[model samples]
Target chain A: MTEQGTTSTALRESITAGLRQAVKRRFGAAADIDAVEFTSLGGSNRTVLFDLVDGTARRRLVFRQETIIPANSPFLDPARQFRVLSLLYPEGLPLPEPIFEFDDEDSLARAYVVAFVEGETVPRRLLDAPRYERARQRFCAQAGEFLGRLHALDPAPAAFLAEVPDSIDPLATTMARIDRWGGVHPALELAARWLERHRPTSTRRCLLHGDFRTGNMLLDEEGMRAVLDWECAHLGAPAEDLGWLCLRSFRFGHVDRPVGGFGPREPFYAAYASASGHPVDPEEVRWWEIFGFIRWAHYNVMQAYGHQTGARRSAAFAACGRNIALIEYELLMTLAGHYH
Target chain B: MTQDAPSIDELLVTVREFVQEITPQLDGRDRYHAQCAVYLLDIVRRELGADGTDATAEQAMLARYLGDGAAGAAGLAALAAEIRSGRLDARSDELLADLTRQVVGKVRITRPDQLHPMHRESRPAE
Candidate 1:
């Protein structure tokens, strides 16, 4: 059967009842579950928007729950995400505040709730909407500065973050992940070999926001309000984030601007260098961009396999198999020095 | 010799019409899935149209690249393993050219739109 959003009628009712009891127990007062809307983000977690009412006090919260859906990253545990948020939110970084985490027997799922950051997370709207015109103009430089600060954080103190494995050799790890899937596209295979051979040496390693791109960021009338989706966070070369941001898939046809379709790469790199006190290497970033496309292609192929094998079935997942060709074409162009 | 009553093109045209009729009726997640369904059908139709030529050309290219009768995915996997283990040079002009040809062929079938404008204007020689 077609997978609807995480909440069916029965599940919704049960969740609301359970949530009411939990909230009451925590707050020492009765709180009504006004409404619950389950929004599927096509990840391992189910995004739930729920309203809690206590007299005039009403709070709209985002409750994330682990689904049966296979996670894209090995490091997507919500407990780890809560730990990351605990550090970032206090530093005045624009992120959802981690409210509470629940894993008790009475709780419906392994879930955590956070105060929702209001904005449009859709890539197209963030890119094209006139309301976001001002936001788009300032986003690239802001993103660069933000990332520089993130990468400069003292990772020594964050022992919990270390639980997510450090990818000492990202190229080898990425290649292994692709090989494990056991599907061969000759272009992908060749690209992998090229990347492996030409792997750059990175001097300093820091926390990399594994999926830093336009779509993962939240935009509003003002500008980029908050960075969302921290599932892929890990300790690696900071170039990982920069390269991922410039990937063709993340750019959404704004090929000219390598930084989130906002503006030129020069300004972004300039800001990052100024803030981080580290020199930005375009070559290193380009290498990661190529790696991003390869990783994304492998992901699409795996998604298609998931559909075919009946591990998970969806029309969208089935269509992902065809998307590998487009990604492969981009990979060839990038390798041939045709695509930027 | 007589063909089947519903030709492949005829079946695709009917499917297109059905999709156009049904898609507007769907909303929210269902509408999204309907769009994916339409796209999948279109890809299938394109694949069916070019199946013979692409398969034959790909097999021949694969055999030539591997320098043996080994062709298709299994052959490519073995070649990839060799490259991974440092036996084969991935940076060689021969391997790059062959891989480009293979990739270009795939783009023609699955995403002709992504091909460079110059290449798209002039379809690759058979």
Candidate 2:
């Protein structure tokens, strides 16, 4: 959070003024915009919260804008994000309701406003807090079942996704992105080569929540409420989502709890199999898990590079460069058959 | 070339103290940033304390694996491209051992805490 009287305050005020008018025009009502506040410094988008007072009721809405400098991920696109939410929201998925999206025509920066759904998104808190005890008990099986249902959806209707070239051959696309990051390591290189040789050819393709991990999920006392961060969603093998969720990093120190630090991997797999009618293959999931580590390590290095190259300046990113070594350490441990 | 009063070690200690001094005063997001600042300084301290042979050993492994004298990021990039293109065998035990050595060497400096509990017993003496 920036201090008051800084340049950020001035910019925030200007954005609030513009947003007040935009909200009135979109809602077709003279609603009063009480205040606009920055919520999170997102990786690919800037998130803000504002309240709209309509007569006697007040509604809290969130606005997400495509960051000026986006993270280097193949699956990120503003239009695709909107399209997925628009499609999934109707299918009864627990996610924020889309209010409106702006494109080139809108004078304000390209962004979308949605209903603010609150819950816990942090990992350690979800893992350790007694408040989330109920959520922890049901999270793994529910998350697996939810992902299975998502993969069961017919991706054909979202044909606009075909415009994104990397929708197919995610391995080659990931390899290209890693090479462009300019930081290389033998462990990552080995993982990529090994994955290339062992990549599975799925008989069935479906939409994958490319980042369905604990940190991305919002949980309450009841259980998982909404799966957030759709920027990385894409069409791929169903097991890829499972593999990513079980990655050691997402486990947040509970390496024993392979399924998002919630429970063992078998129960999660069993739930998914029962729900989707597709038997889970453990070997394929392991291969994708190795792929996940390599992808994550490369991403950390890329984030640091983003700061180093003047594309973005962040204290957190500078720290991320150092964090890559930790991921590389885990990558080697997994590759050497010593992780388990 | 003139005499400097504060050595690198003293500078690191000063920064650590400064972070401690300001930590209690900050709350919420500012506190998190301060913690991150301290973490960066800790990494710098570890880097300074390392014996500094890790890079040389890593380069040697890269040279051996690539079967050429290639050494830095350019060399590693070329090697990665080779492995991806099937010019080099990625399944060889010797290659795996060298890559493991490289990863272990890095983690020793950047984050020894991540080293496997079993592997920690075999860490080379400084």
CA shift of A231, model 1, Å: 0.5
DockQ, prediction 2: 0.57
TM, every model: 0.94, 0.92
Clash totals for all candidate models: 0, 0
Candidate 1 — what's its lDDT?
Answer: 0.77
lDDT tens digits, residues B1-126, model 2?
Answer: 765979887899899899979999987666777888887887788889877577777677677766668887777777677766676774456767766777777777666777877656574332
Q: What does the lDDT read for residue A66 in candidate 2?
A: 76
What local lDDT does model 2 show for residue A42?
61
Would candidate 1 be rated incorrect, acceptable, medium or high by CAPRI criteria? medium
